[model samples]
Target: MMVRSLIDIFSAKAFEIDPLHFQDDDIHMKQALVLKQVKHVLHKLISEDPLESLYMVDIIQRLGIEHHFEEEIEAALQKQHTYLTDFSSNHKLYEVALPFRLLRQRGHYVRAEVFDCLKCNQREFTEKYGEDVKGLLALYEATQLGVEGEDSLAVAGYLSYKLLHAWLTRHKEHHQAMYVANTLQHPLHHGLSRFNDRSIFLSDFKIKNEWKCLEELAEINSCIVRFMNQNEIIQVYEWWKDLGLAKEGEFGRYEPLKWYMWPMACFTDPSFSNQRIELTKSISLVYIIDDIFDVYSTLDQLTLFTHAIRRWELVGTEQLPDFMRTCATAVYDITEDFASKIHQKHGLNPIHTLKKSWVRLLNAFLEEAHWLNSGELPKAQEYLNNGIVSTGVHVVLIHAFFLLADTVTKETIAILDDIPDIIHSVAKILRLSDDLEGAKSKDQNGLDGSYLDCYMNEHQQVSAEDAQSHAAQLISNEWKRLNLQILTPNPFSSSFLIFASMLQEWYL
Candidate 1:
C-alpha cells in the first residue's frame, strides 16, 4: 500500500510540523515534524471532527491567559527578560499603541513555545540582538493587518484571517532571521573575509520572507563552508570575538523517505496536494536525479525506464525487487498511483498529465546525453540537459507536481494555476542564466566556468533559447506559454514575486 507522509494526508496550510527537528535537523525532517505534530494535535482535539479543530484556538487563548498572569507577576517581581515586557516593548517600537496582543492573552498559558514562537523569538531578539531589532518584530506584527487576497481567507471573514496572518507572518519572520543568521560572517571571497563581522555590512545582505530562497541560501552557505573546511581553508566565522553568540534554539530536521529519489520532506508545500509540491520538490530532486543520470544510466536505458513507470504499478509480492529497488519502485509507483486514484475517486478528470510530463522529461534527459556528442559546451538554455549542473536533483520533480496538481479538484487547479508557470519559468531562466554565466567566464573555476566545456574540439552552437530545429522548440514554446499564463491577470502577487525574484537572481 502507498504510505503517504502524515503531512500529505492532512492537507496542512503552512509551516507547522509534528515535532520540530531536533534544534537543527535536516530541513526535510523539520518539515515533516511540524506538519505531523499539527495534524496529530488537531486530530486529537477534534477526535471525530478534525476539520473542526479550530477548537484548539481556545487552547492558545487559555495559554495566553496564564502567560499574562505569569507576566504580571514577573513584572511585579522586577523581572527584566521575560517575554511580556520584551514583546510589549517591541510592539511599542512600531509606534502602535495597541496592547501586546489584541486581548488579555499572556505567556504562561500558551502551548509551550511551539505556537507562541514569534513572541518567544521576539523576546529573545530583544534580549540578545537588542531592542533595536524591531524591524523583524515589526514584520512579525504586521501580519496582523486585515488578511486580504486569497479567497479562502476572504471566506473565513476577518477574525480567522487575522489568526492566519498572525501565523504566516511569524513564519516569514523566522525565515528572514534564519537567513541573516546563516549568512552572517560567511565570506563570499577571501579578501572579504575580514569584513564578515561588520553589522552594517550584514544589514545589506538579507533573504526575504519567502521560505524556499532563505532555506536555499542557508543550505548553500553551509555547503560552501563544509567544502572550504574540507580543503583546510581559513575559517570565516572567526571574527565574532566578544560579540555574544546567538543562542541556539531548536530548528527542524529532515525526514528521509524510503526512496532516495523522492524529494526531501522540507520542500513539500505547507499546503501541497498531489500537484504543487512538485515545484518545491524539484528544488531538490533536479540535482539529485541529475547526479543519478550522470553517474548511473545510459540514454537508451533511461528512455526504457521512463516508459516503464508510465504504466507500472505494484500488483503483488511477486513483482517486487529483492532489495532497495523494490522500495524505490514501490514509492515511485505509489506517488504516481495515489495521485491517479485520488482523481479517480473524486470523479476528477483522468488527465495523467504528470505521467505524460514525466515521459517528456525523461526524453529530455536522454536528449541531454546525446548533446554530449554535439561537440559544444551546453549552455543554460539547454535546460533538459543541464538539470544536473544548475538545479540538480529537481529536474524531474515537476513530474510529481504534475501528478499532484492533476489530482486536486478543478477549482484548486484554477486557483493555483500560477504555481506551474512559476516553476517552469524559474527553472528555465535559471538553467539558461547559469549556462550563460559559464560561457561568459574566463576563470572557469566557479559555477559558470566549472560547467563550461571550454575545449569542445568539434563544436556545435545550439541556440540557448531553442532546444533544436524541430521538437525542442515546440516544447520550449509550450513552456513559455505556460509562463505567459502565470504572468497575465494578477501579475504582482506573492507567487509572482517569488517567480520574479528567482528570475532576477538567475538573470539580470
Candidate 2:
C-alpha cells in the first residue's frame, strides 16, 4: 500500500564544514593582533596571579598551541619553580599535578617528591575530593610521566584509569566522555601529536568563549605551517622519484608519503624541515631493505647482503642478487650523502657510526630470518634481545643525532655507542608495539614470526589474549624505565628527545 520513493534512498547528507569560519577576511592581521593580546593577558597574569599564569599555560598546551608561545611558557614556568617554593602546600590535588606535569614535560627537573605530600594525605584527599573529576583527570595525566619504583604514582595511575573508565561508561553519550575514552586509550601526555590536526581543541575554546581568538589564530597559523610542510614533502617525494624505487616492483613497497609522515611526526618544527626530509629518505631506504630480507631474499642472498653492508662498499654488492644490489648501492650512496653533508657542516664525518649501525641492523634481521626458516622459535627474551636491534632504533638515532647535534663530541659518541638506558627502552617499546600490531593483522607471519608467536610458543598453555596482555605489560614497564631515564642527566640533545618521543608516540 506504500507509494514508491522518487529519490535515491541510500545517499547520506554531505557534512562539509569550514574550520576557519571564526576568522575575518583579514586573517593574518587578526591573528597577529590576537597573539599580541594573548601575550599581554599572559604577562598580566604572571604579575597579578602567578598560579593563573601556570594554569593558562596548561590550557594553551591542552589546546595544542603552546608551541607558538614556548619562550613565554618556559619563562613563566621558571618563575613558578623559582619563586613558588611552598605553593604545593596550599593547592588541590589537580593544582599540584598540573605544574608537576608541565615542568617535567619541558625538561625541568621537578622531583617526584613533589607529590609526596599528596601521597601521605591520600586517604583524606580521596574521601573529600575523590570525585573531583578535573583533579582526577589532571592527576591521571600526570601519572603518565611516572617512573620506576614510584609506587604512589603507579597507584594513582591505576586508580585514575579505573575511575575514568567508570565515568565514561555511565555517560557514554557525553562529549566529555568521548574525550575521556580517547585519553584512556592513549593519554594526552604521549598522544598530543594525534590531536594536533583535530578540531576538538579549537571547539573547546570556541564553546568556552575564552581564548577563542587564540584558538582561531592557531588554526590560521597551523594552516600556513602545513602549507610549508607540504612544500618540503614535495622535495622529498621528488628525491624518492630520483631513486627510481617507486616504480612497480615486486621487491618493495612504494610509499614515500608513509615514510615522510614518520619524521613529520618526530620533529614538526620548520627549522628541522631539511632534517626531517633527510631522515624520511633514510627510513624509506630502511623499509625497502627490510622487505628484501623479510619477503623476497633467500638465506644465501641475505647472508651476502649482510656481508656487503658490513664491508660498507658498493663494490661488495657485485656478487649479490640484482634486487640487493639496488638496495646496497642506494644505501651506501644515501649514507655517504648524509656523511658528506655532516662533514661539510660540522667538520666531523659520522660515516663510520652510520655504517656500523647498518651492519648491526642487517645482522639482527638475518638472525630473525634464520630463526623463522629453521623452524626454531626462539625464547621470548632471546627474540626480544635481538628484536630490539632489528627495530632499527639505533640506526634511526645515529642518523638523527648527526643531523641535529650542534657539536658532536667524543663523549656524546660514546654515550650513543653504549646505547643509553632510555634508547634501549625505546627499542623495546617499538618492538612490542610492532609485534602486537603484526599479531592482530597476521602481517608479520609471512616468513618470520612475531613476539606474540614466540611468547605463545614458549608457553603453549597461554592464550593469544593473555600473550598480548603480557606484551602490553612489558611495554608499560619499559615506558616506566624510559620515563625514569629522561628525568636524569643525559647527553642526548633536546632534538633527540623530540625524535625519541615521536617513536614512542607512533606505537601509542
Candidate 3:
C-alpha cells in the first residue's frame, strides 16, 4: 500500500491566514505600545511578593510572551528559589506546586520533599486537598516535571489525575473545567507554549481588573506573532514550490508549512527567522531522502544512493538513478549553503559535522531497508537503538545548534558529537511516538515493522495491547529521563536545551 500524503490527510485551509490582518498598520503600532506597557508591568510584578511573581510569570509564559522578558523571568525565578528556604506549612498546595513547577522547569533545583509536609502518607496527599480543584490542577502540572525515583510525584500525578477527572465530571460547566480538560490532555510542562490557546486565559483574565493590561498585551502579541509566523510560512511555502522536487520526483510529500511548524515552534522568537527557514529546507530534504529510501528505490539503487551521500559530492552521481541524483544533489547543495551561512555569520565551519550527521541518518535508513529486505526481525532494543538515530532528530538539532547557539566551544561540540543523553532521550521519544502512531495506522505498511512488532516478537504471549502498553511505558520512561536531562547541568545552551524539550513536546 502507498503512504498517504500529508496534504491529503490535513486540510490546507486550517493553516491559512488572512492577508488583511497582515496589512493593518494600526495594529502594528498598537502592538509596540502595548508591548512596552506589558514589559513595564512584568518588571513591576517580578519585584512584588514571590507568590505574585510566580503567578505572573506563569501567566506570562502561558501567554507565550515569556521570551519578551526572559531576563526578568529568570531573576524572578532565582529570587523565588531563594525564597523557597522560607516556605512554610501555611502555604496551600496550589502555592507550593506552582513554584515547584515554575522553578524546576527553568532548571532551578527544588526538592520533591517540599510536598512531604502536605502529604498524609507516603502514597498520597491529604484527601482534603482533593476538594481544592485548583490545587489539584497545580499539583498535576507540577507532577509532569518529575524525574525518576520521585515516587511522591508519581503518586501525586496519579491521584491528581483521578481527582481532577472526578472534579471535571462534577463541574463540567465550570469555567475552570476547560483548563482541567486541556491540562489532562496536554500537561503544561509537556506542551509547546507557542501553540497554546491564549484566548482561554484572556477570557479568564478579562474578569480581573488587575490583569487587564496583561490580557490586552497577550491578545495583541498573539495576533502580531501569528501574522509574523504566517508570513514566514508563506515565504517557506514559496521556496518549497519553486524547488520543484515534489513535482519532479513525484514520490515525496509536499508539506512545507507543516515541516516549517516544527522549527517555528521550537524557536518562537522572530529573530530566528533565517534559522527556521533554513531548517525547513533541511527538513524537506529529510523527507525527500526518506521517500527515496522507503517508498521508491530498489536495494541496489538505495545502496548506490547511500554511497553517493557518503561521498558527499556530485562528481560520482552519473552512476545513480535520476530521482536519487536529484535528491542527492539537493542535499549536498543545501548542506553547503548552510555551512556557508554559518561561516559568514558565526565565523565557524561545521560543514564536516553537518554532513556527517546526515550520513549517519542515511546509513540508519539503509540499515532498516536491509532488514526489511532480509525479512528478519531485529531485537526490540536493537531496533530502538537504530530507530533513535533514524528519527533524524540529531540532524535537525545539530543544524539547530550551529544556527541557535551563541558560542560554539570545543566542549559543547564534544557533547553534541557524543550524542549526549539529551539528544538520545528526545530521539527515543520521537521514535517511539512515531512507532505508536504507525501501529495505529494501516497505511504505514511499506515501512519496516515498529517497536510494537519487535516487542511482541521477542516476548511471545504478549498481546498486541500489552505490547502497546509497554511501548507507552517506554515513552514515559524517556520523558522522565528527558526531564532529568533538562534540569541537570549540561554543555548545551539553555536555548538549545529548551528547544530540545519543545521539539519532543511538539512531536508528542
Candidate 4:
C-alpha cells in the first residue's frame, strides 16, 4: 500500500505538483519518494569504488540520514574493512584518515599505527601535509577517536590543529573556512551529527554533482524532521502546562523548550517521538527537583523529601511541603508510567530499578546540599565521584535505557544496574564540563562547589585559570575512554551507546 502511494507520487506529472500548495498527504508522499530516491543512490554508491563509497557514507552520515541505510552501511564498511591493509605508503593522508575515522565511528577497531608511515624522522607529521587542507581536517577528525596512550595520535592532533588554524587564518573569507572553524571547535567524533544545520551542506557549491540526489534527500528530510520536531515541542509544551509544576514560582527556571532540546538533539529521528516526550518530562522534573535541593527547600524539607523518594510511597510524602509533595508525586507517577509501559511492551518489570535510580539521584543531590550547608569542601576526587551522579546524566540515561532498549536481558539489566563504563564516562564528562562553565561564571560557588573549587581547595598554588585548564584536560581524557568504550565490545546496545554519547555531546 505504501509502495503504491509512492509509485503514484513518482508517476504524477512533474508540472502538476505544486510545492507552494502541498497538503499533508502530499508532503508525506513527497518525503517518502525522496527517501526512496536517496536509498537508490546509496546502493549505487555502495557498489562503486571503495573510496567513492566511503565518501558517500561520510556525506550521508554528516547529513544525518545514515539511519535509513544501516545494513547497507554495515556491508560497505565490512567490505572496506578487508581493504584496510591494502593502503600503500603512497596513499594520501586524507585517503588513510577518512577510513580510519569512519571505521572507529562504527565500533570497528583500527590501529593508530597506520599513520606511522606519515611521520617524518622527528616523529612528527610532515609540514607538506599542511597545504592539503582536506587531509589536515581528516587527520584532525581521526585524532578525535584516539584512546589513551596513543602518543602518535596526540602528535597528529597537535600538528593538524596548528595547520588547520593557519589555513583558516589565511582563508578566513573562503567558503570552506566556516567548515574548518566549526570542526576546530567541535570535532566530528564529539559532535551530534543529526543536530547539525543541513542548510549549510545544501548550500555548499563544492558538493559533487553525482551526490545531488542525496543532498536533495537531506534537504527534504530536514524539512520534514523540522516540522515533526516543532509539533513535538508543541505537544511537550502542552504536557508541561498540564503538569502544572511550572506554576510554582519557586521552582527554578521552567524552560520546557530548553529541557526538550536535550532529548530532541539526542534522538533526532521522528520515530523516537515518544522517548523524546517522556524524557523531556523526566528532565523537567529533574530541574525542579534540583531547584528544590539547591534553592527552595530547607535542609529539613530536603531530608524529608529524600526520605519520601527513597520510600517511593504516597502515604509518607504528605509530611513534605506543598511543592515538595508535588514534585515527589510527579516523579513517582512518571516513573510508574514508564515502568508500566515497559512492562506492557517488553514484558519486564523495571519499577524497582527505576525507583532506585531516582533515589540515588536524590541522595547525590542531598549530598551536595549537605556540602553547601556546611563550610567545608570535599576533596577533588570525592566531589567528582558525587558530582557524577548529581549531574543527573545517570538518571536520564537510566530512564532512557528502558524506554529505548529493544530487548531487556538479565545481562543488560545487570550492566545498567552496575552503571557501565560508558554511562560513567558520560556522566563524568558532563559533571566536569558543567563545573568548568560554572567556574567561569562563578555561579557554582554557593550552590554546589564545582570540581574546580575542589581542585583549588586541594592545590592552593593552582590559579583559577590553571584549574579550569586541568578540568578541560580531564574532560578530554574521559572522551578518549568514551571513544574506546563505544568502539569496543560492550553489553549495551548500539542505540543505547549512541544515545549516551550524544547526550554528553549535547552538553559539550
lDDT of each: 0.34, 0.73, 0.78, 0.79
lDDT tens per residue, model 2, 100-166: 7877777776666766766645467557555666777778888888877888888877877776776
Pairs clashing within candidate 2: none
State the RMSD for candidate 3: 3.3
List candidate 2 stretches off by more than 4 Å: 1-34, 82-90, 120-127, 194-198, 201-210, 251-253, 440-448
Off by over 4 Å in 1: 1-288, 310-331, 337-351, 373-407, 410-421, 436-487, 490-508
- lDDT (Cα, tens digit) per residue for candidate 4, span 411-456: 7777777667888999999899878877877753443478898899
Clashing pairs in 3: none
State every prediction's TM-score relative to the real structure: 0.35, 0.87, 0.91, 0.91
> Whose lDDT is greatest here?
4
Off by over 4 Å in 3: 1-28, 122-126, 202-207, 242-244, 251-253, 440-448
lDDT (Cα, tens digit) per residue for candidate 3, span 359-448? 999999999999899998899999999999998889888888888888776666666665779889999998998888677665433434
- Which ten contiguous residues of candidate 1 have the minimum total lDDT? 243-252
Q: What lDDT score goes with residue 173 in model 3?
A: 95
Per-residue C-alpha lDDT of model 1 across residues 1-508, encoded as one tens digit per residue: 0114323422231123222332355555554444344444444534443222222322222122112123333332222123344342333332221122222111121111111323333345345334233333323332222112322212222222233344445565653444333232121110112112333322433322322332333333333322322222111122111111111111012222222212222122223222332333333233334443465555654545545545554343343223223323533644455456656756654245444444445555565666654544455334334453234322343344334332445654343332355555555545544444445544433322222342221133633223222333333343344333433443233323222322323221
Q: Count clashes in each candidate, considering only residues at least 3 apart in sequence or on different chains.
A: 49, 0, 0, 0
